[model samples]
Target: MSSPVKVYVYDLSKGLAGQVSLQLTGKQIDGVWHTSVVAFGKEIFYGPGICETEPGRSHHGSPLRIVDMGETHMDEQTFVEYLSQIKEHYTADKYHLLDFNCNSFTNDCLGFLTGGSLPPYIKDLPSDFLSTPFGAALRPTIDAMFRGRASTGVLTPPPDISATADSSNPASASSLLQAVAAGATSNNSEMPSSSRNYLPTPAPTSPPTPVQSNSLTTPVHIATNPSSFHNVLHTHRAVVAFFTSATCGPCRMIEPVFEDLAKSKSRANDVAFVKIDLGVGMSNAVGGEYGVRVTPTFILFLDGNKTHEMKGINAPELRTQVDLLLYQAFPPHRHTTLSLPAIEAIPLNAILSSQVPNLDIVLAKVTGFIDAAPSWSGSTTKEATKQILAKNIIPYLKARGSSSPPNTSFEPWKDATISLVTNLSAGELFPVADMWRVALLEPAVCSWSATKFGPGSPILVLLSKAEGAPRNYSLTFLRMISNAFANKIVARELLLSSRSSITALMVAALFHDDATVRLAAANLAFNMTMHLQRLRVEKVRGNVEGDDVGENEEWDIEMTSALLEVIEREKANEEIVHRLTASLALSIRLSPSIEQLASLLEVLQAQKILKDKLERGGCGDTGVVKKEARKLIEEVAEKLCS
Candidate 1:
């Protein structure tokens, strides 16, 4: 059964904003809006992160109005699972009043549940308010008001609200609702301060200007007052504050030690090192607020709360505390605990093929084809395309290949390429595809194509058209797709949005009779493996935006099967074997669930096949490529399979 989803809209200013906004900002704002999604008998909102209460019984009291959104077909269990997946993104430290707030969280939940959004007035208020002069002037004050407070992190959900209740048991849900409503009403008088209304009054005097640093490696000097100190603490997950005075001898003794620690230990945006000089003007206020009575004191704050404090020039103790804070903030991956040197040593940089073919010969072949075709007489598209090649695309590729800045815009070339791919047949498209193979090497072209066309991009379309065509068409198409990996955006789009199509194309190309076509296919595989491995490395290093482990496990499995099949039949080219082996190693190494991949390899009898190939010294003139392939295969066999 579908449940109704409603939006509970509360006026944070409690009718005061509507009365004073016009006079204050010269704009007639309706209200300072805070919205929550009401569904599954709970009022869900984001404040100190994803709080829930009975409908009409939150700390905000009664909402001004309730807007009924459409019903959601998603079951309660499924919705709760979705919430668990997204709860981290809505943490207290990440919330910004104007950027990410209650309304934003409501809109996201509404879209997930009912495929709907909050009302336009509530959604557009921040942008509208910012457009006014007074609103723009108040931005720093607003930022200080919200971000200068200590973060409470993610809140624990109320015990009465059981997210794991059975969907079929209507009585359980009814009991939960009643319990929540009673508990909320009984505690109404004792409720804590609402997140929206917890602002502290700003100081009357203006703050001191901060001494800015050029890079994250340098520690930020505290300026202004206690508010600046709080702002830095609230912004980063882990912070190390150095409290010092200019004339203190011990402060000078440990200054370089602190600088070295900042350079080595600080992570961009995640961890921060701050300096507060008590002898400096206005900065003394921060020292008083933190209650530092002595010089050369080090304090460590995690999630806006003091965790550790140290005094004097004890470098060992300071390092230990800082390392502990990092460990708590970002725990090392389980893979790091394992003994796998080969997997750990894999290079993180992408192996992009940027070699541009001779543009003069490429342009001549394309323009000559256009001139010879009987369909090209007096055609504007043909003339325009020729001009684009000679005047635009050719020169751009030549300049980019030579490492000089290209003066022309990439937009015209993109348009012409799309037109040709749409109009020409597979037989007549090889020359155009060859030209694009060179152009795709340029990052600008790949970014433009990805942004302009997205999933139905010109490169993907061209590859689809050239699928079963002649050897030349296939080779160029493979090279074009491989070169598209030059831009991460395009590569991500192709990997995620067009996974099936790209996978099928790769599998077919691997089985081609032509060695050159198979070689191009191997190159594409190597690039794809490099991209995926880079994501794995980032995730292992605790990058929040890295690709989740096992996200592409299915794709990797499919590609691995095809590669094993091709490798077993390969003869005459050691480069192909080496590239294929490298790709296979990367796919299985450091996999979140290596046992699954090892099982697949064992079922396929891969170990015996690889051993036989190793004994044969591979298929080439020299044993060099074979040696590299053997090393990769053995690494996989021992570390992955064992």
Candidate 2:
């Protein structure tokens, strides 16, 4: 059952009704009114007043009306706390006439307590009256007179029970209402003789219990002997042992509270609450073991190790300690629910159509070193730059050997394009990394992948005219860039800061129908995942990025999903198996949900891709993929599930 609410309305301007009509409203009116909320059984009255200490004194001598704003979910303590918050914010010094007056206060309390607002006729009265021209004209006089009175006398309420009532534990509703009525009928000119002497002793209480372990409902294990005590300690991960004596008065008072808490369903499985009465023939040696020098002592254990001990008849503290220990033993799993930004594709066609430089001449000049360039090697700056601009790089073919440039020529821009990409991969130039990504990379890849190869553009010329060689080179180029990002923090930072567009491009390529393209994209995705995993772990260890580049763990989940999608689609592609396995293995750090875990395991098992390779002791490369896959399988089985 819930407590009921009431609204007390008072006509503050009744005495000056005639003076207000002649000065402002220009017509006879009932009276100016104020309202307050009193929740039945809550033992508190909430009202707003100018420069006032408590409720009754501000609305003194005013005609009163009470309105019922039915049942509330708040209890007596919660209700009192709610009033404390209101009083803290609506102190007399901060009171206002037009903006935040008493009526506004009542409305706030009513809305919270009952989910309903005061009647419009009463709530809108001040604002509607102030909007009138005559009322507006008299605003200064009204403000001056009211504020002067509020600061001097109107805001000064006499000593009410609220002043004496405990802010944490309010007086009973019957007592508060009696105070309200007494304050209302008494003369406002003088303080009541008995008002200051009405302080009531608050009932003893405690804060609400923290969430307990559900297994608390099970019968407590009795440690009648040393062997039984040892067994119980070894069995339970967290044990709350109560050391009480039969003759201790405080222990008697708290025994029921302890028993009731032990019977609650919220207690954890590995945590136990037990009472051992030393007066009931328990040995002194047992008490000495726990260092129990006084009656009503508690000792907590974690994995048979003594962790914390408490003395006295404090049930709340005991329950609190148990909750803390349980939390440490089995912390709640917290996976973020925030959504990742959608991966947007780059517009390649639009970029190609715009100002394209003559790359034919540029490529010719740069390719002069092709013969002298060493074979494509590692990520060394000299080798990578040398290979990218080598002369063997296919030139953008002109129309039918007509030696005429097309209307839209990206072929002439190939040298400059390769140069920019190479520099980006080498971690040389990347101003506004996200801008370069959103503006250049995303649109270019999206447009190029969607369009067919043709003479109209340089890159398209290779994709269309050349056989498998051109496509292979393009895929390899993309893979190299991905690898660079995987190895270099600078490159990774730029790509990630680019609003995940770079990731989007890689994900898009992963779905390519061509096996070579898919393999390259898979490698890139694997590298990106590894890089992100490192950054995430570093962050958890308190390594802050100097640039304050915010990390969104949700993006990792999104990328993981994309990778999983690829795995499911291309499970039979052995060429990508090693990369996919390694990627999935490292990605396990993201803490995927149970449903995701089920899907991932089902895919691995049904395909027999990971299990078979691990059993045969053969996984491509240094057996890293196999090792990671085995580890991931075990981890998923252990942590993500039961």
Candidate 3:
């Protein structure tokens, strides 16, 4: 007989997916809404319908599954209906394990059941599936209670089956016997479908042969044979748990992707990765205790217990949740513009709005992308970025556009724009490459100058808000840049952007010019006197038309050293300075090896020169003009000394 279909299922906590379930939000119905198909070894499969979930009975990591017959043409719509019936008739006690994507499998069953005549697409399901019109036949209805569609409490918490069989009914035992028989018989052709018949003891004459209770007793933890349950991380450490089902079609497709994601996120030392499977049957009762009802759920455990849960998520969401969870748990030991959300948001745009210009430009591009991007891949979180853009940014822009209080222009730049086109001039917007001749040289165009260094203690103030507001999309792009740099991909991409050293640097200069970076860099330079690489003071004496250009500019070693000393010593906060300085040191150490070494050599030489100047004029009767200078020098000297 064909093996009894085993599936993993979880009882969702209302706090996570349950809350999402309540919101009933997502683009699932416009076709491929929360659903998309993936190939199983080249054959398409979709799965783990929500109705198939067994509430209260299922654990946190249940493996509700798909009966993996190779690709079938069953429409996701028909598939949705068929599983609802399966969930009702077979219910919890009938199978070895419940499939999370059971409905999809059921639709697939009809493909086989009706001699492979299932409709190829949901739109072809005929009008009847929508609501029972004259030609509208009733399609399979899901447990609509969660969706607020209608109360199809067909598979709700059966108080008896949940917590000991409701004892009020004396015939409950006999009834359960009959149900079990039907469930077992229905599962296999070889076994008499009704083999386990309702055989009640002879009128309660003697103690009955202890019949196992009809109620599904959820074990504390049940794991598949290859699966294991682990606390993995103690309260003192970070924890990441991978939730999965063995038979699920979508889960199978995403497993490799997940493995890649987890590998990138996990560190064997501080962060822990534990894999949970509901398919392990009675082996992993511990997972059952947590109510894992879905396939491929990722639970972010902080300080030993689940602080956040990511269910029906894909590699990207998994990556995001891990990042945010890790950051919150461990408090990253570095200053960064790349916060958790930004990390997810940035790469998200990089992948989605890839052709768009700057982050601000992409804000408009966000709407166009959402309108055309297609919906979520069936039962996976991969397309979550598209979904999120639709939910958050797209709607926001739509509202702004409709209000039309201003901004009527269609041009990319329609306003009286004053951009600090300077940073883009030297194309320092590109990379750290040096000494490459380029005809791309336009006169230096400086856009921004600090607002007189700010009255509130040396804060940077971008002068022209003329183009609109200063973009704060930094959070999104920050993570992307962080990942790009972390992977050395930015450098590699710069090289590949063009074999021309200039082009790569041009790209780097613009891309890294985001304000978050400057602030992050400034913060890194905070409170600490670390070596500044590339510290040459160019001498320029010229008219606006470039006369007197013969002036020879020399690198003023001691004065530059003094400026460097002031920059480090003037850190507003001691602790911040200490941290930023240490981070600054680390960043330089991580810079491209050869060029940075030369920069370091120059800094060291400059430091020596400055030290000599201080030592040579020690406590001399320097003029009143030099007294203030003496004080500054002594302060810098004391800092260097200590």
Candidate 4:
């Protein structure tokens, strides 16, 4: 470009760097010169005199002069305003300031300002003067935005760039309206459609030409709220947020709880359960940003940022975490794979109330699809729909609930089925602790038995262990309850002891012909060693503490004595088949003075599975260990007395 007209002026920093500052300060040349002046749009330039090069600079660092659109000197007010804008807004991580090097922007900005050129490494730059050392103008905003943060750190407030551009630049509206009305200018005649209405007419005297500014981008903010959030985390001192959603069943289940919590003066005051509408705030862009595939994601926020995010509603467990969180003044909301808490690692109650963590947030996922199939021959689409209907979990549940089958019929997955039947005897299922724990601790059920007579899918849902049970009857038999919630049994009470109240339950648990029922009972026997040891310890402990050692109480010492007395009392013809219990009693007596654990170990050593079981229990490997121990302890105690 030819050297326009040489003009000297003070460099003013404003508008995206030195951008538009010159336009604001410069006066337009009217009449003949209007096209020339406005053609460059309204120019804004700021920076220093680069007429002199530093130690070793090239053409990119060529010397530059100054100019004021109307005068030879800058106005003090304009100068100050320009300085303030850049200090507050200008930022770039590439500008990390080093001790040896200058500040993040200084050296390069000065190079651009004086050279009237860019640094060889710099790409198309923002207002060149924004970084200039002219008055350290951008410092204040820079400090405020960064504020004691790491040099590489960045978290900026929402921008107003787009808004400002729409208001000030006429081209923004004209282009938008034109695009909106493309191929159909038919509507423009009706409405002026004014984006230009926001801006004050910038001195009508200026001509039709537009100013060029590829460097500046007005600040802008995203327009919508979020939909489903996987883990919208946050922290707070008090009840800071609420998590509610449009489709949460448990969120529905516990709506009463949240309301109750809200009503309780202390708890309500302590914390608030916020509702999050995942359905409304969902879109592919934001959905993918935060893993929010499920409804009713509760995200706790203390101030403005996130503290905790959860989906679904398990009242008991949520109460546990929220209660603790309030006491400790921390965030305890957690994410889980499903709505259910990890029944194994954590309390089953909490997982139930916890939100379901889903990263896939598409409607297609919720209403899953199947490929066109030959079996679905009728109008293929309708057939697919029928297939899906048949496969739905809801219908299966409804069908199971309608008949109300006997516990014996569902004995294969008895542990889980009982839990579901008991906990959710009503319409819904809330895996509460008392119920959830027992289901997990129950032994393996018979898979074949369940498959044959069990309400397959429905039983599986209520009794998570049902699927893990063995379904063998003829020759093949399987046993391994590897499912999650099977530990609740050990965590709760049982019906095996001579309490007449559980006699019916024992009959059902033991004699049921279904293989699932039998397998579950066998599974219960795995806790044999621990039961026997605990009984022995209780006997010794009661002797030392002089505590009430009643026959009815469920403890090691008491149960052992009771079992033996019962054996002698009944004097039945049946003989015990599982005999290691006798050997264990002798081992314990041979060394009563030894550590209580030593006696237990001797009995365990007598059986390989028992030893392996004890080893596993020591490492916290399985729920069966406790049950196994309980059984073994009882057996040994009975044998000693015999």
Instruction: Name the candidate that leads on TM-score.
Output: 1
How many steric overlaps does candidate 3 have? 66
Q: In candidate 2, which residue ranges exceed 4 Å CA deviation?
A: 1-508, 511-520, 527-576, 589-592, 603-607, 612-642
TM-score of 4: 0.18
Better of 1 and 4 by TM-score: 1
- Per-residue C-alpha lDDT of model 2 across residues 393-493, encoded as one tens digit per residue: 22322221345533343332344344443333222222112111222232223233222122332233222221223344445444434534432323433
Distance from true position, residue 389, model 4, in Å? 10
What lDDT tens digits, residue by residue, belong to model 1 across residues 1-642? 999999998765455555444334334565656678889998887655567777887766788899999898989987777666555555555555454566656766776676566675764454445544454554555455444432432222222212332122234333432332232211212344332211122111212111000000123333323544665676689999999876899999997888667745655456777776676434577788778999999999999999988999998888888889999997765446757655555565555555667788878877776776666422248889889889887777777756666677766766676666666667777878877777777655664566544434667668678667887787878888888765565676677667778778877888888888888888888888777777677666644334322266677678778888888877677778778877777776656656567788889877765555565455544432545456766766565545
Off-target runs (Cα >4 Å) in candidate 3 are 1-405, 409-642
Candidate that beats the other on TM-score, 2 or 3, i.e. the better one: 2
**What does candidate 4's lDDT look like per residue over 1-642, in tens digits?**
211212221111111222222222111111100000100112222111111112112111111332222221323343234324233222222111111011112222222122221221111111122222221233243334333223423323312323323223234323422221221111112213221111111121111111111121111111112311211122113542344444456667766666455333122112334343333222233444555666544444443445566667766765665555554553221211123211112111211111221212211322232222222232224333433333432233223334552233233233333333333222222222222222332222222122222243332333343323233211011122222213222211222222232222222333445544433333333233233333333333322111111223223332233223322321111121122233234223322333443444344332333233234342144412344443554444333222
Count the clashes in each prediction: 0, 16, 66, 85
Report how far residue 349 has shifted in candidate 1, in Å: 3.7
Name model 1 segments beyond 4 Å from true.
1-5, 8-100, 104-346, 374-380, 401-406, 548-550, 617-626
lDDT of model 2 at residue 162? Answer: 34
Ranked by lDDT, the better of candidates 1 and 4 is 1
* Per-candidate TM-score against the hidden true structure: 0.55, 0.28, 0.24, 0.18
Candidate 3 per-residue C-alpha lDDT over 43-140 given as tens digits, one digit per residue, 9 for 90 to 100: 12121122222211221222222223344354555434443433332222222111122223333333332222112232122111221121111111
How displaced is residue 142 in candidate 4, in Å? 36
RMSD of each: 17.1, 24.0, 23.1, 29.1
Better of 3 and 4 by TM-score: 3
